[model samples]
Target: MTVSKEQIAAFYSTDTLAGDRMAGIDGLRHTGIATFMRCPHRTALKDVDIGILGVPYDGGLTTRTGARHGPREVRNQSSLIRRINVATGARPFEAARIADLGDVAFTEVFSPATALPEIEAHVRAITQGGVLPLLVGGDHSISYPSLRAVTENGAKPCALIHVDSHTDTWPVFQGSKFHHGSPFRLAVEDGLIDPKRTVQIGIRGGQNITDGLDYSRDSGMRVMMIEEFDDVGWKQAAAVAREVVGNEPVYLSFDIDALDPVFAPGTGTPEPGGITMREAQRFLRELQGLEFVGGDIVEVSPPFDSAGVTALNAATLLFEMLCLMTD
Candidate 1:
C-alpha cells in the first residue's frame, strides 16, 4: 500500500530527534496495528530507507515448534519501544527513513526447500529497491535465505557477525541439509558469506558430537565461546568482531538463544551459561559504526513465556541493531 505524505506526517513526533516515529509520548503505543514500534505499515519501499520485514515460518525447527508465532508477538511487544535511545542518544528514527514492510507471505510454510527461496525472493525485492531489510525471523534458518538475498546469491559475499549459543555449522540434520542448525554451513558452502570474515560469539552448549564446533573452527571463523566472552567482557568481544569484519559489508544474525535461559527462555533451543541481557545489550551497543547491510533477531518463541520477556528483549535488541544500521 502507498504510504501517503499525510499518513507520514501524522506519525511525526514533537521531539526533533524522534523524526517520523509513530510511537512517542503523544501516540498510544498499545493502540494501532502492531507494526514494528507502530511504524506505518507499507509493502512498497517508495520513501523508505530501512524496511522491517517478518518471516513467520518455523518448519526448519528440529527442537521446539513455536517460533512461527515469533513475528506477531514481537510486533506486539515492539510497540513498547520509543523513538530515541536513552543511553546512546542515537535517534534511529531521525537517522533514516524506516517503515514496517509487513511479513513475507508464504505459499507453502511446511518445508524449507520451497519456503526458504520464497523468503530470498521477498528480501531480494527489498534490497533491489535500495532499501536495507531488517528482518524478524521464524527461526535461525531464515538467515540463510536472507543472506542469500542480501548478497545477491553469493555474487557479492559479505562478512557475518553471528551471535548464538550454538555454532550452527553442522553439515545436516535427519537427512535435511536446510535445517536451522546448518545455515552457516550452507552459507559458507554456497559462498553467501566469507568464512574467514565470519565471527560466531556466545557459543557454549553441550554436544552429542562436536562436528559443528569442529567445522566452525576448521572453517577459520573466529569462535568466541561464552567462557572467553566472560573473561574478556563485552567490549573486548565487540572489538574482536569489529576487527574481524573490518570495513567489509556485514550481516548480523542474533539468535535469542545467545542469552541465558534466565533472560530468554522462549527459544526453541535454550543453552545455560549464556550471555546476560545487560551484556548482550552492551555488546550490540558497542557495534555502532559497522557497515551493516542488514540484520536479524531470530528464534524468539512466545509460547514458552507467558510473560513475554523474550519478545521484549528481542524488540530492544532489534532497536539496537537498527541503530547500527543508521549513518
Candidate 2:
C-alpha cells in the first residue's frame, strides 16, 4: 500500500508540525514597553506572548482625556493586518528585527517629569543595540524622550517629521513644560533635534494662535498647515519634507488626531476636517527613500473608540512607517 508522490507529500506536510504555537515572553518583541506596563492584562492579550508591547500611559496629555490605553488596542488590531510586503516580500519584523522590548519603567504613576527620562533611557538602550524603536504612545510627549535617546551619545542631530493636528510648539501649558503639546519645543530647546531641518505636517485646529505661529517661525521649524496640503498636494509636501530633512536621519511622529475625528474619534483631542487616511498614506509613502531612524504612532484612546477604527488606523500607519524604514 504505497502512497503516490502527491499523497505522500500531503501526508508529510500535514503530519509535520509548524513552528512553536505557544506564546511567551521569549517570543514577544518590545516596542511599546511603556504601554504594556500600564495595563498588563490588556498587554497580555495584545503583546506578552504575541511580540508586541503596549505603553498605555498618557501623562503628557493636555486634554487629560485618558489615551494611555492606545498601545494595547492598536497592537491587538494591527496584528490581524500583518503580511509580507508584496513588492519587497519582507515581513516588517523580519526586515527590521523589531522586538517588543516592553515599556519604559515609570517611577511616578502620572508624572511626565519622571516618565520622560525613563522613556529616554529605554529608547537609548534600544537605539544603542542598533535596533529601531517603534514607540506606541502615552502622548506626543514621548517623542521628546525618544528623540533625546536617538541623539544622545553625541549622535548627529536628526531631522523631525511630525504629522499632527497641532504644531506642538507651545512653550508651556498648565504650568508644565513637559506636556504633550510641548515635546517639539523641548526637543528643540535641548538641541537634541535639528530645528532647521524639521517639518510639521497636518497642522490645524484653533491652537495655532498668534503665539504658536510666532514660535513656529522663530524656531525655524517648517509648518504645513492641513489647508496648505490640500492646495499643494501630498507630492509637494513630501518633496518639502525630503528637502528639509535631506540625507540626515529623520524621526517620524504620527498623532492619530491628524486624521478627521470621523476616522479617529478616539484621540484625546479630536480635530475635524483633518487629513483622510488616503492622504496620510500618500504623504507617508513619499518618504520611501529618506533615512528614517525611529518613529511612533500615538494618541489612540480605546475608551472613546466605538469600533476600534482609530486603533486599526494607528496600527496600519505604524506598519507603514516600519515599511518606510526598510527602504
Give TM per candidate: 0.93, 0.82
Total clashes, candidate 1?
0
Off by over 4 Å in 1: 1-26
Candidate 1 residue pairs that clash: none
Q: What do the candidate models score in CA lDDT, each in turn?
A: 0.89, 0.74
Per-residue error (Å), model 1, residue 244: 0.6
Q: In candidate 2, what are the lDDT values of residues 126-206, reduced to their tens digit?
A: 676556677888678888888898888336678999989988888777888987888888888888788889898888898
Tell me, by lDDT, which candidate is best.
Answer: 1
Q: Which ten residues in a row have the lowest lDDT in candidate 2?
A: 16-25
Q: Determine the C-alpha RMSD for candidate 2 after optimal superposition of all C-alphas.
A: 7.0
- Cα error, candidate 2, residue 131 (Å): 1.3
